[model samples]
Target: MTPSARDVSGKPQGVRGFSGALWHVATRAPAELFSALEELPPLVVQVLHNRGHAGVECIREFFNEPVLPHDPFLMRDMDKAVSRISQAVRDGERVCIYGDYDVDGISATAMLIETAILLGIDVCSYIPDRVDEGYGLNTEAVEKIVKDGVTLIITADCGTTADEEVALAADAGIDVIVTDHHHADAVPSRATAVLNPNSPDSDYPFTGLSGVGVAYKFVQALAEEYPEKLPYPETFLDLVALGTIADVVPLRDENRGFVIDGLEVLRQGHRAGLRAIGAVAQRPIETVTSSDIGFGIAPRLNAAGRIAHAQLALDLLREESASQAEQQANELDALNTERRQLTEDAVSVARQEVGDDPVVVSVSEKFAPGVVGLAASRLSEEFGVPAFVGTLIDGVVRGSARSPEGFHLAQFLGRHAELFETWGGHARAAGFTLQPVNLPKLRAALVEESRALEGDVFLGPQLHADGRVFPGTISFETFQYLDQLAPWGEGHDQPRLVVENVCVQTARLVGANHLLLTFREVAADIRAIWFQSGQHQADMNPGVRVDVAFRLDLNVYRGETRLQMVVDDVRPSAGERSLKE
Candidate 1:
């Protein structure tokens, strides 16, 4: 009997060494099941089942059914939060919305402020400078807000683990309501209410909400009470979608609904700032998709935080004037361009400093604290390891860490809690602050901890394909069927299909490092594009047979729409490999 392709843990351990990856092609659906679902294509069924939506009802709900928002009251401490906020509104107390300096944080801040404004409450927003204050709630900022006569501090996208800061605010006679999604060690007892789904006592069925998602939940609950004040709750879904997609949360359950509905809201061009941002990004707001948010809009919003302060982005979200919104959008676009260059330069330097260690840790004053996370994320992907990138600032080290699939960053950081001044984030991404004296100890501890894991755990990337498709099966109709599964991100990735034994008819270099190729798939000739593969031009000569992993893409040129293959990776055909050897 043959062993299964999956390991004991059921993770796919594919046949290694095809374009430096182990292709984990999913097994085909059972014939009986395929026959039973004859209304749908077999390929769609196979992809859906692979994504854990195997049941017919689950499939239907995922593709067709509407996912309504869950009751925000389901979250523990919601009533307390609402009650305190309501009192502030009633007494006309000064309230400050303190948020982090990321897109999620900014969107959450904007959403809450808009809600408060709609309810005729006195509200102001504060987003700490990323370079100066770092992430999460800070004591100095709290003290300043308190000094400004703020009687209540409503935190969005942050304050989950700010035990000391929350205590400071409480001492200053300021009520604090923490609305965040980051994992917390323990709910800050000092906070008036912690509205995080990741809290241990939380009963919310969908724990995958982003910080903006949580804020939207708060708005939903608040609207229920003050329907006269907050008339249209759905008006804020655009911000919810922006932050939810930008934060890279799982696009499942309620999150899927947020994005699906939010996309509709976004398309309406209701937000002038979003319209300006779309104009700057060269993306039409009416035709924007999830990819547009992830690649085009989110970066510009994040750039304000990364390169300067997040207040610019928060203001943009709240701005109504088209001219002012355009100016703000242009400023953010410029910052994003600068951020990209800084990240590339920092990643290059960090790569040189990183030795052949299981865990890569690079620290230097040269790296900007704001862009260190981007550098760390890139390094993690480049080196196939957990990466910790930090910058030494005023005798303290501020850092960000990004991990691969197997490693849990928050858990790993928690194990060494005493080493840092502060630390908190989700499982895959986290940030921390520590003294310079702990650098050596931290490096040694990480190296020792990483040694316990299997060597192959961080070995290269793994490409998961939805089984295999023959050249003849690739059709516009098939692509349209797959297109029904919209709003893909995080847990629900766009499908990658494998085509075996296709002959390359022609290859030419296009823009930058992109390779334009013509492939003969049986009797059909299809146009395919492989980005950043110009260096592999020699391997794709005419008459060369290769196996390609690609995604179906719709290309429209000169009023004609055609199906094209967006190649991900290519390898010599199985037969050709044997001949070469």
Candidate 2:
């Protein structure tokens, strides 16, 4: 049966997607909005409307370069952080930049340390081992830093909520400037200066800065504080862009500006680490896009923390020597391959335990804490439920949880605070430590809690289209026009289009479980790729009529630029379905 929805463009849209998904097509905008943006293509206008940039001025401003980075002093304690760090620089006090293990943390750490060293401050970086020390500022790590005689600690991407650890450092005569972007439930009263835009005390205009983005702000404030000595702060946007995009923050406001500008710096090949990383990943550093960082380089950098020591990744980022950077980048690339295998194995084992539960909770000694998050995320996407995967080590469990929509992971974990040793994360993802015995209780609790859900969550597995496309309408030129809304990420996704009732020219299995497809068009055949969908080739053979949802992209292969359609979903056309029935 064809489920229909009346579109704003006065057409009937097929709303039911293949494999039980819901497809939403944005066919038009409000009359006033449409009239206001009549000069632009209707597809772009529809996309702009869906993204809530309906205002004419707002749309124009977006097309233009994003405004300059905001004033850093506007943050809650920018002055305090600058003054203390400047003092540390002047006095030659030993300082450390404590960072997390992920790409966001590693890149933020590198940026902050580079800034500090450039300012003539005696600084060293300390990123905790993901498997050994866990995340953030631990008391043991703080004590170790104290033993190193460090007097000041600048935390990058972490330490906002390390109240007790901050107190411990404060007791040992070390001051901590927590420069993080995570939500602060209660600002650490003991931190010398907390510089999170999301902090309760912050009046920073934008709250979406990533860990490295916050570090950029810190350095920007420092540049304003010391105009003469510090080198150009904009030089670090390469790192900022890498971290900001990798962290998956909304690519709006300052984040968008950073990526747009940083892509230039990253492409300049100034950073030896990124260049080497791009080479190892088979992505050209000179023309890297936000998409490149998210899929290509960032995962390799993150693999260091996931499979081994994060220090190696940090060393690569800070490496100035091309040879060393290449060696380290290659090492990270190998680790990424290993991490992929580990995650696949963990997910395979975890999948068997899912059964028919509304929520997935599985704990095993075989699950490594490093890749549990990936496994949990995979299971959540596959099963459309909250998944909690834990590594059972020595009677305790270090676990990661992932949820799709309509469930707040952090809030749910918070409700069961009594069962966990430590827990914290945002709405959709979280981590916790608890006794192994608590697994069954948490599982039962999650299932019970899921029963009360309104069930709208199950209605999803939804696909959103900016507009519709006919077989002959989408071209490379069309992609170029819509791409003016460039640097798409978390909140701003690349526009998708629905092409209904197109004839398949060919569908063949290509590299490693991917479907290489082509559709008949007026001027030329449209080449398409449906990655990981080789299993569907039988049904998508030549001459099959189908409705396909896809996004346009320009694939640069061996110096040739070709317009390619990345298929999102496909289903038999109404006529074909009727014929089969």
TM-score: which candidate is best? 2
Task: Give the clash total for candidate 2.
Answer: 0
Residues 1-581 of candidate 2: C-alpha lDDT, one tens digit per residue: 11111244655565555544566677566767657867776677777777888688887776764467899999988899999987997899999999999999998999888888778888888999877888899999998999998999999999987999999999999999998988747878988899999887778999989999998899999998888866589998999999999988988889989999999999999878889999998888987988899999998999999889899989998889999899999899999999988998999998788676688888888887789999998888767688999897667899899997789987888788899988877778788899977888998999888877845455235667877666666777678777888888988999888777788888888899999888876235458989878878888878888988888898878888888889888877878877978
| Per-residue lDDT over 240-328 for candidate 1, one digit per residue giving the tens place of the 0 to 100 score | 99999999999998999999999999999989999999989977799888888998999999999888888899889989999999999
Which RMSD values do the candidates have, in order?
Answer: 3.9, 3.1
TM-score for each of the candidates: 0.93, 0.95
Off by over 4 Å in 2: 1-20, 522-525, 579-581
The pairs that clash in candidate 2 are none
Task: Give the alpha-carbon lDDT of every model.
Answer: 0.85, 0.84
lDDT accuracy of residue 443 in candidate 1: 86
Q: What shift in Å separates residue 174 of candidate 1 from its native position after superposition?
A: 0.7
Per-residue error (Å), model 1, residue 311 = 1.4
Model 1 pairs whose backbones collide? none
